[model samples]
Target chain A: MMKGADPDAPRLWREGDRLHVDVRGLCCPEPLVAVLRLIDGGEAGDGLVAHVSQEPLLLYPELNARGWRYRLVAPRGDDEVALEMSRPRA
Target chain B: MTLFLASARSRLLPASVPFRFFAIAAALHVALWVALIFAAGEFTQFRGGVGHALGAAHLLTVGVLTMTAVGAAMQLLPVATTRPLAAVWPTKTVFCLLAPGALALIFGMFAAHVGAMIAGATACAAGLLLFAGLLADNLRRASSMPLVRAYGWAAFVALVLLLALGFALALDNSLGFLADHAGLALVHMILGAFGFMGLLALGLSHVLVPMFALSSAPKGRVAWAGFALAAATVAAAIIGALLGLPSVLAGACGLGFAAALLHLWLMRATLKSGMRKRLGLSFVLVRVAWAALALTPLFGLAALAGWGPGGTLFGLVALGGWLMTFLFAILQRIAPFLASMHVSRTGGGPALLSDFSAAAPLKVHACCHFAALAGLALAIVLDNAPLAALAACVGLAGALAFGLFLAGIVKTLASGKI
Candidate 1:
């Protein structure tokens, strides 16, 4: 489940109250930009899962530094890792 | 996310996938050219007359043109997005499929191999779908440059339409969807040439013309207008075709494309005014690109004027004259830029642009090549096969010279000028 930051971020999708974007096969800036666009559009919530490949080691630290609360979700037999991210309550 | 900027070595290497495909495509172009030359003078056996226009032209236009454009976009969009490729295997797979597929498709045309043609189209469409997936990622990213964004989006849509049209043509030829095949060739040209390739070129030129020249890009409405006019004109042309409205609309659209070029030329003038004072042969090459831009409109003029068999000449003007000449001009910049960037990133100091330029023979060849093309255009105007042949022979000489010059460039790069 993914989480929203501002609660005003546009809801592209909802797992109940959370905005989730399945960023599987989605590369950088794409995933981030889409999320930001939603946020900027007055949509926000919890459980924003940005599922992406963890091949680039450089990507994760940047996400963490941005204050995104993320949990890495790993599935069996798949090369991809899903980062379940949520915004803290303001 | 941080903006995507190319690393040193990455510049030299073709963006992981398309470079290999483009290489294969260029090889196909050269081989098809060879065949066209051989087919001339003594081969009446071909369904069409013996000439470069018959086989090589199709292969060059479709195989080389589309392949290179697709590959460049695949590589470049990632760079723009600051995104790495989705999957290496799929990218490689696409190239592997498209290369042999294009050849088989072309051969399939002459051999009446309906199955092969259908198979080739399927393979290519699959490859393009993969490419589109990658590009979609880029388009999703936020960019301040709306013109680039708009053009990128339209190019993808145009690509989808072009592929659909290609499928229709393939099915008609293979499955006999329409036995007569009404103006299918013209439709293919309109969609592929004007819609897909033209828009891609125009969009990318907005980047390349400025970047290589170290000039300020064309901003504001002029850039957007160019994109809008091209997209609208292409759509109108296609609509006119379907409606049986008038051939004149097609002429109008072509004139509109010429107008787009005129806009670009003016924008290029703007780029020039602000460029670094000590620009070199790359600048000269860019000027040549401008000259080619002029030819694109001249082609539209020739088409509009209803000159006899002039469409063929006009096609060459747009295809080889504007597109190929612009491609080569950019290549001259790209090749050296790549080498220099690689060397510098690894700690080599500044180097002269002339150090990498293809001097002597390549220069001579370029002159001959342009002259040969001009002569061929003139011959078509005169409707003289003998003169066309003479021009083609000269063209062949120029091609050989270019090949030798390319070898020299490689040699110079390997020598380490820094």
Candidate 2:
């Protein structure tokens, strides 16, 4: 679980081996930052699933820079998307 | 909404598309200062009409400001709206038409050549109309970012009017078709500066400022209210100009002041709430621009009241101090940001923004830009041509430094060092 985060910040929870972040209501860099925070905080092998209302186009470069790979996953509904991300293999 | 992975790549135009405009804008920035340096004497005494002063003004407005706006919008609007441009060729075509056309137009104004002026005006009108159409298409598709869309639509309307006015003014140079040339010229300036550029800057800032600062956009009714006031302000100012009514213009300025205050307050709150406290040197320019934005209406009121050199000062502060400064500030950031994005997409992992920026040149640029603005302001107030020339020299130096900063990015990208 994400700790001491703002109530309006993205909601984060764990599902077995993966962390899920609901970033639907967040704007711009907030969505990008939330995902970055999870990557920075988690263990090297931990995986993340981010739910976003808009596509995070700006986040791709940051993910690439940090050696993380991401792909679009099945969306939850008509207005939300899930992006699955994982650290690069050694 | 169905999310496509390919949408990411689609949203970002090829690096060449935006960078070409930036490169041309950088070159024209240098040319503008050089033109000013030569025309500094005329600049100090400039009471409208045509000549080198007019040419120099267009160099900044069309060559630098509009060029950069087109490039930035082409790249950014797509991403903001989550839609790719229908085609990239039109953008290239716009560049092809506007760039040389702007040069020809400026040259014609400087040399008093009607033929070049007419030819250039036709080309530029064609290019700008195409750009407006493309922008309209994108704005129509934008479901999110309602405030930005609203402003975009307003600015689009302003752009069309300005283009029409500009074309008529250009033709009037030879034909002498108008009874009140100066009056229409004033209307053209107001439409171009406040209507098109002002609204665009305000709208884009809502997105760019927050994105750069890592903060949420200033949302809710306050933001919407600011937009409403700004739009109304522009409309009132245009009507006042067209009718030659100082009282109406004064009222417009009052509305403009309120709008500026609301805008500055919103920006201040946005920065305060930003996660990234240190927004870097580019933000210093942005802050200066915001100050100019606040002062523009005050200057307008002074101009209306017939204060010393107030009319010229109003034009300078609004065009040079606010719009040009803001564009350069944003350019410094977005150029690198876009370059880095392109570099990242090239498969060898992401490129850092620092790798694309040269700090020393930018520092020199910032210092010299402020000095030139201050010096020019003083020169205009005192009607001192020598001082104006000196200020233009300082501005030229700053423009050179900015050009070097841009050059460094181009070099790095070309060298594949990023």
Candidate 3:
């Protein structure tokens, strides 16, 4: 059996002033892929936060290139830090 | 907002720079195999000399290995370091120098042409020096990822040593100035194969393997130990070779074996803990590469003990069985990956990686590659020249198949179908 395979990991949710895309158990391109999927599915407005377990910095290029603005937030308690992303108004 | 824009532009190079290197590397892969096919008779008995066999070896080393490393490092290393390349023009100029320079060097080595070898070697050196400069600049700015940074720094120092020795060896052919040409050559090979390429592979695996498998990165201490041991092994091996110390060389092999095993253990742990269970066909090749890496030190020990054909076997497995296989596997994934990223950035909507890659050519290549590795190893073991030639033919076919795969990706991109 694969270790650290959390099948029941949180996918995403919405809270006050932000839609939380929880990728806390994921790694690398998964986080980026999830974020991109959300953007592609017409969730490109302000207030989408992606919580990635590791290496969230790699997402910045793709985010910025796709016209999304992001600010990396430090972790709250034991949670992974969040990348809060939004497309800027013209 | 301003920071985001600046960061994005800082990290991204013109896609053409890296893609061009990849194109050259893919083409050269086929070219090297073709060269091997023609030189197959000399290949089995090759112990190191300037001829068809030497040409083929350089075609693989300078042309394919170095070229691919340059391309991948330029694009991926920056991302790992969180620093942009100094500029794109130097990279473009590197390809300009490396591509033709590699060809000329191969031609010179094959035909025993002194002037061409010198000229080609000089051009190649110049290109590599520029690359080293860029790498150093990027690494200096890399404050994070200390293990990766250490690997880069070590590879940089090794590059400097290899180039210096490489130039002397090339000149020795014409001038006979060096008293110990063979000794210098051994050190050059060690530094080139292990110090530069091996270190990069170890370091990048920490990031690349996990990224692909969607697993957490290996812990820092394990990675650091691997690096330190690998460095010690390479240094000890070089010293042993120069000073003719068998015990030291054997100890180096032992250290190398440990380092490789530790690395594979970490990779295994990563895979086990990975979110992505089915990593696809590319990873099969990666596994083969890892196995080859693990077995390389054994071959080295055999060579040190003066076993028949052990030295040749070590070279074959290290170069062909491990480095080539690993690079191709990564290339298989990255070409489509980078292309998808490019498409998305270019307003093509989220491009699926599967959309950019076709399976047929890759499958064909994978089959042929495995057959080639196994066949060549058997042929070497049995001292069978004809079988070795046949193996080279099989490898050539595989390389061609890989080329076709890359060409398909290019075509897909050109069609704006992403």
Taking the candidates in order, what DockQ does each have?
A: 0.03, 0.28, 0.12
Give candidate 1's error at residue B409 in angstroms. 6.3
Q: What is the TM-score of chain A alone in each candidate?
A: 0.54, 0.83, 0.76
Estimate the TM-score of every prediction: 0.70, 0.91, 0.85
lDDT by residue for model 3 (A5-51), tens: 65423476678867777765543334555676667667645658777
Candidate 3 clashes: the total is 0
Model 1 interface DockQ:
0.03
Q: Who is ahead in TM-score, 1 or 3?
A: 3
Give one digit per residue, the lDDT tens place, for model 2 in B263-363.
99999998997656888999999999999999999999998888879988999999999999999999999988777755532445557776676899999
What would the per-residue lDDT of candidate 1 be over residues B184-225, giving only the tens digit for each residue? 556566677667777777777766665544444566566666
Model 3 regions more than 4 Å off:
A1-47, A51-90, B1-10, B344-348
Our model 2 lands, by Cα RMSD against the true structure, at: 3.8
- Arranged by lDDT with the best first, the candidates are 2, 3, 1
Over 4 Å off, model 2 = A1-13, A24-30, A33-47, A53-55, A61-82, A86-90, B1-9, B344-348
Report RMSD (Å) for each prediction in the order shown.
11.7, 3.8, 6.2
lDDT of 3 by residue, B280-333 (tens): 999999999999999999999998888877888899899988999999999898
Error of 3 at B1 (Å): 20
Q: Fnat of each prediction?
A: 0.01, 0.22, 0.07
Candidate 3 clash pair list = none
1 versus 3: better DockQ goes to: 3
